[model samples]
Target: MRAVVFDQFGAPDVLHVATIDRPEPAADEVLVKVKAVAVNHVDTFIRSGGFRTNLATPHVAGRDLVGTVVAVGEHVQSWQVGDAVWANSLGYDGRMGATAEYVVVPAERAYPLPAGIDPIQLVASVHSAATATIVLQSVMQAQAGQRLLIEGAAGNVGRKLIQLGHQRGLTVVTTSAPRDFERCQALGSTQTVNYAAGFESHFQLADQRFDHIIDTSGKVALATNLGLLKQGGQVTLITAPKTNQFTFPVRQFYTRQQRISGFVISHATQDQLATAAQWLNHAFAAGLLLDDQVSVQPFEAAAACHAQLEQGQDHGQRLVLVPSK
Candidate 1:
């Protein structure tokens, strides 16, 4: 099996396609013949030694994959050979990655691909959809009709949050560039505010306050958004710069019973991943979550793709790699 392997953490150049021994399924796992895998920022982060250091040498770094089951372990009765499946919890936490000719996945973590869904699009949506599902459904436990605000709404995860929030009957407001307002609205955002024009001013003018606020940009200051929350509201942070910091408004935060929490999809438990997979399958089948701007590249181009992503050259396009047979 030719897999993207990195012997030591460094630059994107450290990644290369190498023939490695194919893995066999454990008692609770299945062997998947790789079709397509999505390259994520976290993959580059781990590759560059910015996140998760104690990795085994020659690590593979793909988190989402859409593939066909080639074999199943003895205890795995739910799946069998030829089953089309997608998984998002790979390439992290000591697990072998999906950027290979073949990868092994725990049976419970492999989700059946929705009928008629494209493997490229399905692979692209898994990471973002799973993060959105965990954040909105599991972490926040958002209810229908609640007001929600999403920062950086034009990005992948932010867009997922808007679509899922709208589907669940929430009033979704988003902050993004003025050019993206229409795009966000088309994705189910009820309102879009120009972040450059100042979100605080827009909300103040509209007298808007949300039951929940999520900063997908990681650049939005918590103190600035706290005033935009309704009483007893909650704020969720999913992305941010490593050195970013803000002064806490302790008095107001406590007085209003406002709460702030953070979530990384990498930290999601097996059960949480399963829950996300179910929602993602339904969303894909309904044609509600699709990435129209995906760039399909050869599997061997992993290193160049990583460089493009790190250099901000991807232009918000989801990059999918198809393994060469």
Candidate 2:
């Protein structure tokens, strides 16, 4: 197996590909022949060592991949050879796999790719977007006919939120750069705002408060979003607001009866992934979740992809990576 490995993280240039032995499936695990892998913001954080987690030397950075089952351990029965699957590598205990030609899975973490879905595009959205759906469905308890606001509306999770929210009959509002307003609206965002332009006055004057909010953008403060939420309304914080940006504690969020909670997909149950995957496929089939906008690069260019990611600007929605041919 040829994989991209970095012992130490600093710059994208530090990543280098090397051929290593393919991992064998342990009991209760499945060995997969990798086809496609999706890059998430987590991958970027891991590569740059931006998170508080300390991973010891020699880390293979990637958290999601889609592939075919080449072999299954004796204890595995739900999956058989040749089944197509996508999985979430939640970085538990700094496990190594993905970003390779072949990898092993615990079987439970892998789900089959349904019919009528483009494998690559499905992989592009499913793994990370599951977190977004979980934020709405599991954590925030978004209900039908409610108005749901999604921050980072143009990013991976935001795109899924728009589609999944609409599927659940929730009105979707989103914040993105001005360039994505039309596209965001098309993605079922009933009202769209460009937060970079100036969110305070814009959202404040809208005269309407959201029933549920999914804050994927770290830019929105708990206090700011609390003001945008009606009493008893809920807000799911996917990214925590930076401490330096505020002097006083974001106290109103607790006293105002505004429900503010953070969503972590790693902590989700298997049932949660199954539920999210079903909705993702249904929405994609309905044209609410567009896959045509995603762009894929070869795995050799993982470093380059990280560079584009670090620069904080891109023209597309999802950027997938495939192990070199």
Candidate 3:
């Protein structure tokens, strides 16, 4: 099997396609023949030695995959050799990655792919949708009829957040560029504000206060979002600038009984991943979460895809890599 492997972490150029031995499933695992995998920003971070260290030699760096089950371990009864499955928990925490012709998945982490969905679209959505699920369902514990404000609502996770939040009966408001207003509205945002056009003033003028606020842009100031929250409301921060530091009105935050939480998909447990997978499968089947802008590339182009993401050139498009024959 051929895998995109990086012997050392540095630039995207460090990644190269190499012939590697195929891995077999352990008693609790299953082997999948990779059909398509999505390239993520975190993959670039790991590849550049920024997010994690002490990786395996010749490490593979993909985190989500759509594939077919080719072999199942003795203990795996839920999946057969021909089942179509998808998983998003690989390529981190010392687990083998999905950017190969064949990868091993722990049986509990793989979920059946929704019937009649494009594999590229499904694979493109898994990583972002899982993150959105963890943020909304697990971290914030968002409820219906509450007003939810989403910062940077045009990006992948932001788009998913809008759809999922709306489906959950929340009144979804969004902040993005003017160009994305209609796009965000179609995704389920009831109200859209141009972030560049005096964002705080727009909300303040409307006297809008949200039960929950989530910042996916990583560019919004913490203090700015805190003012938009209602008493006892929660603010979830999933992305941050490189500085990773913020100054906010701590006294006011505590006095109002407001809560702020940070989440990363990598920290999600197997149970949380399973729950997210279930939601994603249902959402995809229902045609609620789909990536219309997807660029398919051969496996060998992994480095170029990583470079594109790091350079901020993806332009809200999902870049997918398929195995090279």
How does candidate 1 fare on TM-score? 0.96
Clashes of 1: 0
Per-residue lDDT of 128-195 in model 3, one digit per residue for the tens?
88899888899989899999999989988999999999998999999999899999999999988988
lDDT of 2 by residue, 1-325 (tens): 6887777768888777887778888898898888888776677777777754544234666768888999999999999999988787534345554788888888887887776667788777775568877787789888999999888888777887887887789989888888989978887888888777457577677688889877776777666777888878887767676663523235666666777687766567779877877776666666545554667788888888777777875455577889863
Could you say which candidate leads in TM-score? 3
lDDT of 1 by residue, 1-325 (tens): 7889898889999999998888989999999999999999889998898887455335877878999999999999999899999988887777788899999988888999989998888888888888998999988999999999999899999899999999989999999998999999999998878887356887888788889999887787788789899999999988765677777789999999999889988788999999888888888899988855799998889999999999999998998898862
**CA lDDT, every prediction?**
0.88, 0.75, 0.89
Q: Please list the residue runs of candidate 2 whose C-alpha ends up more than 4 Å from where it truly belongs after superposition.
A: 52-58, 177-179, 194-206, 241-255, 269-271, 285-288
TM-score of each: 0.96, 0.86, 0.97
Model 3 pairs in collision: none
Work out how many backbone clashes candidate 2 has: 0
- Top lDDT: which candidate number? 3
Backbone clashes in model 3: 0
